[model samples]
Target: MNNENSKLTISRIIQAPRSTVWKAWSEKEHFEKWWIPEPITCKVVKMDMTPGGGFETLMSENGEEFQPHVEGCFLEIVPLERIVFTTVLTEGWKPNDPWLSMTAIITMEDASSGTKYTAEALHKNPEDSNKHLEMGFEEGWGTTIDQLEKLIMKLA
Candidate 1:
């Protein structure tokens, strides 16, 4: 990958099957549970898991107020295998202005213990990529993934 278009990849092995993880990701109710860090509630406004479909969410510290956290479009979806989303476009392929446009590719693979999950955030430019890193992408993402693991484990 070129440095100009920086990409950050994070992966984990969850003690669950790909179907379980995919269910958590594909279902609105299940997704919101671990999509964000604790203390911050996540509301799934819209989720159409198909190419050119919409994916929107709101997050709020207090239940009273909710603000837009993610407004993106699904570029690709392979059941139980992979998902690709981008913030550059909204539902219906409408373009949107974002502080930093990026495409996120999430994949799931079978593992000896369970499932190997990976998330890759690809930025348009190095500056934006560095900005995400500076904004604690690793910590935030890792925490959310951990939360996901816990949820899956409990449900398992």
Candidate 2:
């Protein structure tokens, strides 16, 4: 898929350093707290960040049953800098056709104020990209990023 129509991205300057942001994304404890917007909980099922490792999570609104959130494979992990994962493949590079498929690229860079965090979700086609956008891709991801910044504020 081409970059112009088959992708959605969010870029924001957070008040924390890249190290802090990296920890929030890398560490399980910090990740769970802000990965999914709160009230709705996000549980890390597997977080092996190495290439070809599994990256999965479960989400629940209540205290009881949890539903599958994302089942993806880590395509690349550049410590404190970048992370690339795809729903097109599971762990060990196994193929899987997920209900909603996309590859997410997360980047952290040292900015003047703090970290410039960017997230991009790339779909295989324009239709898939539009579907994700119609599903509130911006609002949902923006809310999570806001939550993350708040969490970092508390930590700082």
lDDT winner: 2
Weakest 10 consecutive residues, lDDT, candidate 1?
Answer: 1-10
TM-score of each: 0.96, 0.97
Q: What is the C-alpha lDDT of each candidate?
A: 0.93, 0.94
List the candidate 2 regions with Cα displacement exceeding 4 Å.
Answer: none
Write candidate 2's Cα lDDT for 28-146 as tens digits. 99999998877899999999999999999999999578999999999999999999999999999999999999999999999999999999999999999999999999999999999
| Best prediction by TM-score | 2
Q: Record all residue pairs in model 2 with backbone atoms less than 3 Å apart, i.e. clashing.
A: none
Q: How well does candidate 2 match the true structure in TM-score terms?
A: 0.97
Candidate 1 has which clashing residue pairs, if any?
A: none
